[model samples]
Structures are given as C-alpha cells and as structure tokens.
Target: MSIKKPLDPGQEAVSLCQHHPREELCYSCSDCDGSLACPECVTSTHQGHTLVKLKNTPDFVWKKLIEHYIQKAEKFEIPKILKELKFAEGKLEQNRKHYQELIGVVQQRGEELKEAIDRITMRHVNTITEVAKENTVYIEYYQGELHSLHTEIIYALRKCHQANDTEDFSVVLDSEKIIRAGLKLPRVPITQTTKYRMGPSPLPLLESAFGGVEIVGYRPKQLGPTVPHVVQKKLEKPEPPKPALYSVVSEFRHLTDITSLVPTEDVYSWISNEEKKEVVLLDRAGDVKQTTGLSLHIRDICTSPITNNLWCCSEYDYSVREMTTPTNTEVRLNFPFVPRALALTHNEDVVVGTFRKVCVYNMEGEEQFMASADKLGRQIVASPQHISVCPTSGNVAVVDWDEQSHDGNGSPCVTVLTSDLQLLFQYRGPQTRALRSGKSRASSTRKNKKEPPPSFWPTDACYDAAGQLFIAERTSKSVQMVSNDGTFMRNLYTDQEFSPKTVGVQTGGFLWIGFDFGIVKVIKYKQ
Candidate 1:
C-alpha cells in the first residue's frame, strides 16, 4: 500500500463512481474524485472538503446511451414486424370468409322474397282486372235504361240535379260476384309484420258499407335481380406487435412419434339370432400390461391354411411372429420383423407387405421370396397397411394404393397373379357397372349402369375355407365378401354401428372382425 502512487487533486483521480455496473459491492470512498475509475473503485481522498456532485453525470449519460441503442435495435427487428403483418393478414382472411357467408345468406333471402312476390302479384292482378271488366258492363246497362225512358225522365233529371251533377253518378254497386272474386285472391303469409299498412278488412268487401273511395293498403311489387344485397365485413382490432426471433424453413416431415395406444374399458359381444352364441367378448384379456391376452399391435389375425402352428397378421407387427409353444395351436411365425400386412400360402409360407417390397418367408426363418423393388412403386402411403393382398397359387394377387388411394378411396379391383406371381389380369368383380361407377360392386350382380349404394373401404384381405376373399374395408364399416377367384359377393358387419378395422378367416367361413378397444369377433355363416 505504501509503494502505490498517491492520487492527487490537481491530477485526475482514476476511479469508478458509485453508480457503476458492480456498484452494489463497490463501497468506494465518498471523496475519491473517481473521474477515470469505475463505480467499484475505492479511495482515501476527499476526507472533509466541501463536495459538489455533478448534474447529469457521465455514468448516467452512458447508461442512457446504451439503452437508446438497445431500443433502436428492438424496433427494426424483422421477426417483430413480420409477426404483426401475419396477424393482420389472418384477420383479413377471416373477415373475408365471414363476409362471404353473409353475402350468400342475403342473396338466398332476396331470391326467396322475389319469388313469393311474383306468385302473389299474378293472382292479385288477375282478380283486380276481372273487377274492372265487370264495371264496364254495368255502365252499358245504365245507358240503355236511359234510352227507354219516357216523360218520367224529366222527374229523373230533377232528382239527378238534387244529387249534385248529372255526370257524377254515384250509386252503391251490388257485388256478390266481385266479393266472391276477392275471396279467391291468393293469401300471402307475411313474416315479421311491423310498420306495414294492411287493410282493416283485408279485402274490398266492406267498401259497400263504408261507401267512400278509400285506399286500404299498399301492395308489394315483385323483387328483381338488380337489387344489390349489401353485407358489411366486420373489422376486428389489430393485434399487438411481437418481439423478434430467428427462423428457418425445412422440407422433411417432423411428425411426432406415435407411442403405444392406451386401451379403453367396456366391450360388448354381438351375435346373430340363429347362432345365439356370443363369440366376441368386449373385455378381451392380454391388451394392456398383462399376459394371457393377445399380443400388442395385432390388428387382424388369420390361422394358416397349411399348418395350425402358423398365423398371419396385418395391423400389429410388421413381420410375421410365430409362437414356439409345445401345443402349437398358438401363432408361431415371427419372421419378417415389421409386416404391416400378411398373407398365407396354401403351404403356410408367409408373404408380407413391407415399406418397399413384399418379403416372403418360410417357417425356418429364411427369405424364400423377395419381389422387385418397383413391385409396388409409390404405393406405400401412411406406411403400407393401405395395400390389400389376395394370395393365389404360391404367388400374391395385389390391389395396391397406387390407383384408388391417389385418385379415389373406392375399391378399384383385385389383381390376379400366376404361380410365379406375374400379373395375369385385373378382375373388377362380377359387377362391371358398380366397379366403374362407384356402386357396391359386391352387393349387386346387375349388368347395367345404376345408381350406387353405400360400400366398404378394403384395406387388408384374405381367403376363407371356401376359397373366397374376406376384405376388411377401412371406411365401409364392414368387410366385403368376395370369391377367392375375385368375384364380388356381399358385406359382413359385426354390428350395425361397429366399424371394421381388420379381417381374417379361420374355417367354415368363420371370420374374425376387429373393432375398437381390443374387441374381436368370431363370426359363423348363416346362409
């Protein structure tokens, strides 16, 4: 401390002020004369001299200067301005849509009013014109009576003078016919009647009792298209400006990963009156965190035609999973890993629909068949459960999403394949018109063009014991029954309101219908 240079009053006292950034712990000397120092600076000088503080000191001035710069940067930020602009644009679009709706309503009301006025006017005009024609006949009769008059006419002339003028003939007209004609006038129902003048009698029938030319009410004219219907656009208050932030645009999908779905309580069993046996239980076991129920993600399950140990799946797992149980009544082929859809061969070899190709597997966990990469080009949307497979002589008959998915959701047709899985022909069901015109092709067998009835959306399909295809339509809320050779048959629904998710056949046309909340149906054939 003694070796340190002493600060002098004549020279600059190099120290910071009390108002510096770290001033809370600064605790500097009161008379330090810290012109060149920070607020944390301490000093031993200015012990007892009369001190005068600077007005609008440099520390305060520097703080204000930094704050001014920050405020300027905040005003010019792009994100802040862009946010306000977007809000304004969104409000304007909403106003436009609202105004458009109001304009449509007003236009419709105007048209309705115009048509009503036209109908009433035609009937009223015809009735009024007939009354005017009848008055002409009455005037002719009065003139004829005057021509046949004798010296009695002199007395009639004196009576006419007493009545005021001869030409002013005001006699009370008899009008039973015209009064009946007024009764025939069309009645117009008016809504919201206020400030409108209506005749006290509603007709000219009481004109005889009143005996004066009195105007009862005004009639409305027919409305025309020239009338401009006005609808004001409701303007809203402008939203506030936002703080600035950085942003960038990217193309790839950032969709959220879908975790396991939680199972809901409550299931109901459905049955036909003929069978009377409850096959599908509402509260099926093994869905939640438990054993003895079915495995996870098993949408639709089908037993293999060749072996009792093998089964295929479409909804739950990607590849086929086989059970290694000793009894072997269980499912036993877990080979393909991630099979969205699966079909069994007559020998129980599994054919699975994958992301790009159809991977065929044997019971020994070997890849027996791998189709070409373009075997199903661009057909995998929503990751490939969308394609339905109908297996034939060791090969696959595929109906992909390439056509009906992109163009329409309707079931287009099933493609047949040979033993080598070559495309043989496209079968549009037995009903041609329904296939082309969107009618239920499987429901009707008619050969002509007809109005279509409601149908199903087939997502996954397989054949039953009768060599018939049971198609699980995603949207039809039912399964379509078709022959294995690809002829349209009928539709199967578990319940009237239950939507069909996945379908498979075990034996005797025994089909399993999958619905919501882990409930599956075991159906028995009726006819």
Candidate 2:
C-alpha cells in the first residue's frame, strides 16, 4: 500500500564533487581509473584520453528515464499489480459462494432421496401388516374348531362321571366304552406365520440415490508475459505498404471451356466443358493425373473439406453430387434453384449461391439455412456468380451480378453474410476517382474506356488461408485480391489471353486461375 513519491524535475541537474570544493562533478575523464577526475586532472594526465561533460548531455534523457518509470507505474506495472490483487480477491469471494451453493444442492438432493427411502420402507411395512392380519384370521378359525372338539369331549366325560356317581354300573361301563371308542385328540391343524425383517442395504444403493457428488471447476487462464518490443516487432508481420503483385509462373493449355478450378494436396483439379463429362486432376507439372467422369453438366466444383472428395454442382439438373472416387458419384441434394457457385466451408458444409439466394447445406444435401433477403426484407442476392467462405471468420461471401438492372449498367458487388444467413457487409469494391469527383456514369465510362475499369464484374471468387479474397474479373481478364471485409487489397493477376474466370489457391502460395480460352495458369504470389 506504500507509494514512492516522484522526484521533482526542478531539482539541480549537476551535483558538486566531494573532493573538489570549487568545481561541480559536471565533467569526467575516461582515462581516470575508477576515480572522479576534475578538470585539473583532465588537463594534466588525461588530456589526450577521451573526456565527456556530464552536464552537456541532454537533461531530457534523465527526464525521459524518470517519465518512463512513472509511465510504467501508472500504465502497466501498477495497474497490472492492482489487477492481480483484485482478481485474487474475486476468486476468494467466488469460491465462498460456490461452496455455499454446492452444499445447498447436496442437501436438497439428500432430502429427495430420504423421502424416497421412507416411501419404500412404508410400503414394506404395510405389506407385512396385511399378511399378519390374514394369518390371524386363519389361526382363529382353526382355534374355534379345536375349542368345539374340546367341548364335545368334556360333555362326554361329565355324563360318564354322573353315571358312575348314581351307582348305575351298566350305564357307566357303556359310557366308558363309548368314550374310549370316541376319545381322540382334536384333528384341526394350526397354521404359523413366518417372521420377516427388512433386508441389508444394496451395495450400490447409496451411489444410485445420491449419484456421488462431483466438483467440476474452471479458472480463468493466466496470460503469458508481455512480449518485448524488439521481439514483438520481429514476430509481427509488417503490412504491405501497397498490395503485393502476383506474377504468372506457369500455364496449362488445351483444356477447353473451363468453368471451375480447385486445387488439392498435390494436384490441381478443374472442370471444363460439361460435354466431356469429366473432371481433370492435374499434377504440379500440369499433366493430367486422373480424369473423373460425371453424368450431369457440372457448373462448379470444390474439394470437400470433410471427405476430400470432389463436390460438383450441376446447373442443368440443379443437383449437388459428391464424386467420392474417380468413378463413384453420390447425389447428395437436388435444389429447386440452379446452383451456380459452390464453396466448401471449414466445417465441411457446402455453401451454394444460386440465382436469387445463398444457401448452406451439409454434406448430406440437407438444406440448413438460406440468405435470400436482407434485414429490411429486400432481396439480398440477384444473380450470384461466385461464393467463397472466409476461413478465419466462417463468413459466406457471394458476388451478385444483376445484368438486367439499370439498363445493364449494373455494377457487380460482393455480399458477405454470416453462417446463419445474417448480413455482415456488402460493398461494390473500391470507389473510383470519377465517381468520387461527382462525374456522371456515362462520362466516367467514356473517360475510363482506354484504362482498366474501376470495378470488375465478379466472375468467380475464392479465399486464401490469410482471409484474402481473389476475385476473377472476366471483362478485364484480371483477378483482384480483396480483404475479407471487402477492402481492395491488390491486383493478383491481369492477362491479355487468359481472361481469368475462376481462381483457386493451392497448397503453397500458388494460384490456379481458369481463363476463357480454356487455359489454367499457376502463379506464385507469396513465399
């Protein structure tokens, strides 16, 4: 709880030397061995050696050092210490509350178990009482029969005794003979009730009743030490001053009518003309390795993140099929709308962008959700040309091109939607200087006729691991790299004959772009 008072800046900067009374210790000689040498010593033996004036040095350095200490105290050091103390106190309070709550829960559970046990004991007791009553009835009936038999015997004995007392020898003898003939123990049987006691406790009975209390816990994770400035600067990647440019490294010719391009672990797979009914997987050398045939006309194809199979969308049948092997095809889903663009998400879900809506489906082809309208009930997608999922954010991005709008002056734009079909960001790429300067659309078009168009009509889109989007502009024959949030990052590729239509990022930093002339270009953009 103690705090050190700060030093005053107005204090004297230079102090006087203890040995020299007249001069201050403002200057020192480098040659003087471990002793504070005055100006006289500097002029005597250490004239040639290096000498520095302590007072001549900037006072700001000392001031800055003091300020840095204060800054750390006020900003980092003191605050961090206080935070640790507060956190410790909070943990103690939380532990106390948790202990009380746990006890309450245990007591409540015990009471419930006790009630159940009492009910079970009472049921047994009731059964025992009823059985005892039934036994008593049976015993009473047998006792009554025995009593009647005893009465019959007693009456006979009394008659015989009276005959003997009256001196009637003949009658007494007759009675005795009759009594002897009839004399027999009562034949009524008596029944005994068996005793019972409550049995021993079952071994697992307590465990089953209470479920054995368990304490599960979690504590906030402690953060690692703050990175030093020198180390952090090295660790952090410097943002490109201007976006980096991509150059063509290689090209594959002869694949005609290429529509979709996808790259895998060791090869690049692409779909060309539907009439061929085949998807070609090419090695790094652009040599055909495997050709998988499909029955339907494939519009787009992406590598499934789950099965690592080739997932193809047929625009003709509006069907989604998974090409498990080279010859095996599993029809997963048939959609009402024609699926145009397809992208496999990190979670292995298939994201399809159709004519008017963006739909998400699992690998089984079950429709999960759709983003057809915006928050204002306005149609969000018009003609979705391409779809890509941001790996970092899991956001589904769709490029919609409406050719019929504004008399075909429609500028294609990108729409980013959440996994749950909620809108995140929609942008029409970067604004042009002509548009920003309040120029008319016609004038701007005329002015930019000779130059590359300010914005591109999105033909295809794909995202890299760094969350950068590579969009193919068919008109300009170029591919632009954009940020996940729709900021224009850089032009990835522009070519005269290629006319990039669809693009894909490969294992390394190589880009596979399919062009209008059935050419596939593999370009390296990053190390």
Candidate 3:
C-alpha cells in the first residue's frame, strides 16, 4: 500500500540540461507528467516542478513496479503450496508405520485363537469316532452267529423229516433259541470280556443294531450306591499338659461382635519371659437384653486401668458398666449426648464425647462436668471417634470432621475445648466442598451425592510408649495408625486381616484390635 520507491534523485534545480550532448541527454518538461514544449524557454516560472532529463526511455520507475509484482506472487502463493505438499508426504509415512505394527499383533493373536478352536473341535471328533467303531465291531460279531443258527435250523428240519427213523433224533435250534442262549449262555470256552465307555451319540443308536437291522436285547437293571471296602488302621494323638491359667477353656460363637480387647497381667508376664502373650476380649450387644425403649448401640468399650474390668457405653441404656471376667453386667449411668468416643484419663475420669458436647464421668458413672459445646454447632455435633482426654492439657481434644470441607454440614475439624464447655482452639484439614452453596446440610449425607467417606474412619487417640500421642483409624478391612498430633504414621496391611470395629491399648504396651465377628487379636510390638 505504500507509494514511496527506493530510488532518489535529490534535486531537479539545474536548468534542464540544454545540450543534447552524446545524442543521449535531452531536455524535458519541468513537470515530469507530460512532454515539454520546446524546453520551456528556460523560464523561472516552473522552478519548483520536478523535471526529467533522462538518458533512456521508460527508466527505473517502470522497472521497479514490475519487480514488486513478481515478489508478491512468489511469497504469497508458492511457499504455501510447498508446505501443504510436505505435510501430506509425512502423513503417508506415519500411516505406513502404523499399519505395519498393527498387522503383526493382529496376526499373532489370530493364530492363537485358531489353534484353540482346532484343539477343542478335534477332541470331540475323536471321541465320537471311537464309539462308532466299537459299536460296529459288536454288531458284526452277533449278526454272524444269528445267521449261522438260522441256516442250521433249516438243515436239521429237513433231515428230521427225511430220517425215516431215529438216526437224527435231537431237535434243531432256531434263530430265536440261539439268540436267547447267546444272552444267557456262560463262557463254555473262555472268551475276553468287553466293557464300553459311554460317549456322545443318539439314544436310539445305543439300543439299535448296526446296519439298521433289528435284534433282541434286554434292558439293564438298576443298582444302589457303591462303597469301597478297606482294612482299618488306627493311630493315637498325644495330649499336651494344658496350662489351666492361660488356656482358652471356653468359646462363644455368634454371641456378639467383639467390641473391646483387654489384656491381662499374666499375658504381660509371658511377654517379659520371652513367650507369646494371649489377650482377652469383651463384646456387647449393649444392654440387659431389653427389647423396648431407646435402642442401645455398643458405641465404644474400654478396660478399666484400676480394676482390669471391661467398661462399655450404651446409648439406649444411657449407662457405663464394668464387667467381671468374660461376663458383663448393667451399671446405671447417664451421658450428655449419645456417646461415640470414650477416654479414661490418668486421674481415672471417664471422658466421653457426643453431639456438641464432651461429658466427664467417674468410674461409677457419675457426671463430673459437661464440657464445651459452643464451638460445635448443629453443623458439627458428633465425630465418628475422636474424643481424647489430653493428659498434657487436662482439656479434651475433640476432632470434628464437617467444617474442614467448607461444607455447610461437613466442616471436618478437631477443636480443643476446656472442661466447662468453653471453645479454645480448632484444627481442620481439607474438607470436601459443598456441592451447592447456600443449601441445606442434610442433603450431603446421601451416599451417592459427591464425595464418598474415606476408608479411614477415626477410632481412638492415645499415648504411645514414649508418651507421644497417636491415633487409630479403623475399617472392616484395615487398621492404620497416625500420630495424635494428626501426623500420619505407617499404614498396617498384610498377612492377618481384622475388621477392627474398635481398638484399645493394653497396659502391657500392645495394640489390640476388635473384630466385628466374635474374634480379637493383640499385636505386640517388639520395639
């Protein structure tokens, strides 16, 4: 679009070159647009006009315009066509490589499939052929005997009529008698016995004769169940001396899901003496077997440090109870809300957390204090299992899990609260966000909504041997441990699997897992 050209003729100031020297230089009009009229008489009137004194016809300007058109054609059209042609060539090469590689894999797989088909077809064909051959041999032998008997019958009958005396006395046997005898006759001269193994064929063929001829045959009889007879041999098993103290003398099946694991001083003694330790377990259906009123769920269970007895929380019964060895009894108690987690502090106070509050009780189930609830709103009431009575703080740390997601309902959190229901500190991890903001929370509880609950559900929090706090997350298939400060520890998975419906730490420094079934295991760490 630009009009300027590269060539510059600085000034046309000189009076048009008047001399026609060398027969090339000529005078032109002061203005270059048209021919000059007789050299314009050399006047100053056309001084500012551009003048041309060319030495040749149609000089540089016309040549420059032709050059610009040639460049535009080469740049715009030729290079684009070349790029497209190269791209097509590369695409074809790539396709060839792809088809070659695919051909080998397909051919190899097809061959294997063909061989499998052949093997299966041949097995069936061979079996059918074998059975047909056997039947043909049997028919030929029987038919020959029947034909011979018929021929002999005719000759004997003729001889009897022509005998004229008792010379040929005995009667001739007909084909019918021969056939009957063939079936009944035993081995007069010993013959090999033949047994046919059954194979695929029409049922009618099994009874019909070869060559489609009719023959006499008998139906087989039915038999009873077969048994093998053998001589008897006996061996004795020696009995080991039973340690009356540690042996499991009784077993209860399907009685209850084991809810707590309690280890004994006797088991600890065995551990110190370089022997395997045995753990005792306690489980409950959660009451005095009452059928009415509030239905109690066995939320949590623990062993009393002072009495070595089992204690469990029951929502229906609203009670905490101590059970004597392998047996439980009802103890009247009241909890602030439905108890979900239970903790026994060093001072022996029973700490339990439920909807929006933590309640403290004595060994006898008497209320000590109704701890904090302000920080926990309707949004966060009860955690699955995260009520830990901190020995260091004497304050309870309750981990709520709903708010961390910034969800209307699912603010997942762990709040440190005082003994008198006062809010102190709060901790939260990443929470699954609410699918719809400014919506009701109850909708989030639906199973298929958005985020599924993690496999790791909180179970209990306690101190390790070093007094460092730790936590347990349990499931039907796994049990994992994490530091009480919410630090992740190594996950435990392998060999033995336990439902770990609940967990407890033994006074003997072992970890106990409670199964949903009526079984329990104690994992003792060497370290």
Candidate 4:
C-alpha cells in the first residue's frame, strides 16, 4: 500500500461516513446516540433526527453529563449526612467527658477501698504477731522445764549407782533428794500450736461497696435515609394572666428605716433596721412577735427555708450569725471581709455579699466557693448591697451598687450569675422613656431641653415561686418585676409616695415591700 502522508499542523484528520465512503463525517445524529453522518446520509438515513455539528458534539455531550451529575448531587442528601456527622462527633465528645467523670469516681472509690484494706491487713498482721510472741515465750518456758527435769533424773541415777557400788547409806540418802527433785518435775506443760486461718475474701463485698457499672443498650431503628413524617403542630395552652397587686393586706410601720426584709414560712417575717441595730420578727397582724438585738449594726438579714432560722450579717463585726428562734441562740461565722448582704439558698447554704465578692458557705461556715472576678479577670461587682438565690434555679442575683464606678455614674445594677459564679447578665435599667420616644441622650443634651434619664439604683431583689425577680428600685419608687433571664417585664407596683428599699416574696402570693421611710406593706398578689 502506498504510505499515507502526514497531516499538516493546521489540519485535522477526518473520518469518512460509513454509509458514504467518499463523504467526510460532517455531523452527529443526537437521536441515534451520536452516530456520525455525512451530508448525503443526513438527508437520507438520518432524516428528521436531531443533529449537532461534529465540531460541537464533544462540548454538548460534556454539558449534558455535567447537568446529569448536578441533579444526582442535589439528590444525594449531603447536608443531612453532614448534620448527622456533626451530631455523632458531639455525642462522642459527650461520651468522652462522661467516661472521664466515671473513671474518676471509680478511681477515688478504689483508693478508699485500698486504704481500708491496708488498714485491715495491718491490724490482722499485728494481731498475729502479738499471738506469735506469746506462743514463743510459752515454748521457751516449756523447754527450760524439760531440761531441768532431765538434769535432775541423771543426777539421781548417778547417786543411786554410787550407793549400790559402795553399799553406803550416805550416797543412797543423797540420791533420795535428787529422786525427789526428778519426781517433782513440773507436769508436762500443755502446749498448743497456734495456726492462722485466712478469712473469706472481701472482693465481692468491695465490688458492691464502690458500686457497679450499668450497661445500657441503645438501638437505632433506621440507619440511613428515611422519609420524614409530616407532623401536625399542636396548639399551645394560653398562659394564665399574671397577678396584679389588688390591695394592701397589712402595713407595718417602723421607727427606723427597714434595711432588709425576709418573709418566713410561718405567718411572720424578719425585718432588720440598721439604724435601730436590731432585727424583729413581725406577725401578719403588724405585731412584733419577737425582737433580737445585735451588738453590732445589722447590714442584712435572711431566713433559712428549711430550718426557718434567722441569719443576719454585720458589717461591723465582719461575721454572719445564725439565730435559732425562741431560744435566741446564736452561731457565729467569721469571715475575712465584712458581710453586707446575706441570703440563704434553698439547700440551706449561706450566700454572703461582701465589698466586691460573693461567697457561698455551708451551714458549718466552710467556704465552698468565692467569686470576685469573672472568667475574663474582670471584677464582677464594686459594692454588693443585697443578694438573693433563686429557689428553683439556684442562680445568685446581687444588687451591685457601684459607688466608685470607673464611669463615675454610681448607678446600681442587678447582676445575675450561675451557682458556679458564671456571669449571666447584668441589668442596668429599662430603655429610657426618651429613647422610646425616638430622642437620643446626645440630642437632649445639645438642645438643653431636659436632663438625661436618671440612673437605676436598685436596693434589693428577690425571686418568687415562678422564678421571676421582684426588684426594689429606689430611684423609680417602684417594685419592678424581671424575668429570670434579666429582662424587665413590668412594674409590679409603683408608688410616688414611698421609695421601696427592700422587697420579699412570701408563699401564697404576698409581696412584702419595705420602704425607705420604715414602712412595710404586705400586698396580696394574684400570681
């Protein structure tokens, strides 16, 4: 065959249509799965078929393939898979933490058991050693007695032999003394071997002492892609209307300002007057049930929910005292810093607010935790005036009055924190009324129209059964209700006549608002 010439650089090699050998393939038939066709074949064999130029067929095929893959990828459920992967990672992390905690518990218990076993082993060893020492002494005494008897018998026999050989009465008489000694040999000392027997193993008891692990099995019903069910939304029940302060049930007037108020489980309350340097228990009928005088000025007072014991702190003595009612017996707990505010948690632990720190103590006055700075190393409070612990959540809420604030505002704020002292949120006050009116503080100052809004000065705060905080706002002359999350809900009661200095909530929906003028009003609340 003649050698085919190499194609030029600028020219492309062409294939001839099978149907028409002379004609070059000029197009591709889409309906025929991209079969090659020439002009003659296109008109005859591939008539009425979708055709693409052979030059453009490769790009068209590539685009169609890409589109097909795009649809497939969209239906692959990749997002759901990624979410499941993240959930699994989180679960693994939780498992790690839980296992670590369990391991620590097991190790601690094991150490305790080891100590107990060591003590028991030492005790048993000592007992056996003492018994062995006594047995050794007895064995030595018995050996000496046997040696003495053998010597006596040998002496007596020697004396008798001399008497027989010499036929002398003197030798025989001497042998009699020896024989008497041999005959009088101490009765064979009764000896008993001391044997030690191992007691039953304590392995089973120890296993129960430390506790056993529980194995729980979890089975997933379906592993992979499943059709999600269409769940109908359930109607939520409407919340009951919040109770309003209908009327004053009873009002008690004091000669001195009431610095703190604590309602008790009984139909009485404990009120402290710093000026009077005393705390009094008042009945529902505004009668003084009992009065307790303090040597030092009382800064704040609270009552234990469990024991109903009165607890008060003194800034003068730098101490917290628990007073058992009726007997008036006092138990003093000393602290490094002066305690200004006092509260008792639902668990009967003491919560003390000092200059700039909050401390927790058990009933015996052992400090469990002290919180002065936050995780960021920033001081949490400048001056804590009052403290309250949420009965439900155990959150500590403090009325922080910053007299020496960096900004020199000297405004009081309410700071809420977890039991571990993690900062939650701080409430300065609600949005200024001017701000609600679309007026800025800068605008007001520039126009000289009105003074900026007054700063919030909270005197005290307490939580109700619903976990809502009732704050005594000295500047606003109102008892404000705040949600547990620190949002200002509404003013529970506002009085232009008196400034509330302290607020307390009692069982059966009663609000005890202590005013600056030494007036305590018992208002019945609906909620």
- Please report the candidate that would top TM-score against the real structure: 4
For candidate 1, write residues 1-527 as lDDT tens digits: 01223477576433334445433232322333222333233333334433324333468645654576577658765668889899999999998998799778767766776686688788777766676666656665655555544334444555556556545444212332342333232333332312222222222443343234345688444334454433111222357786332121111111111111111212221111111211122222222222222344443333344344333352343444543342222444564455655556656666665543455667776787664322443222212342233333343555443223233233344444444444444344344422321122232223243435424334455554334566665555666766544557665543566565545443333454555433455555532
Candidate 4 accuracy as lDDT = 0.76
TM-score of each: 0.33, 0.49, 0.36, 0.50
The candidate maximizing lDDT is: 4
lDDT of 4 by residue, 395-452 (tens): 8998887555322225457888788666777777776321111111122122323434
What is each predicted model's overall lDDT from 0 to 1?
A: 0.43, 0.70, 0.47, 0.76
Model with the higher TM-score, candidate 2 or 4? 4
Which digits, one per residue and each the tens of the lDDT, describe model 2 over residues 138-167?
A: 878878887877877777778877876997
Model 2 misplaced regions, further than 4 Å: 1-244, 363-365, 405-409, 432-455
Tell me the spans in candidate 1 whose CA falls farther than 4 Å from its real position: 1-302, 310-319, 326-337, 363-366, 372-416, 425-456, 492-495, 517-521
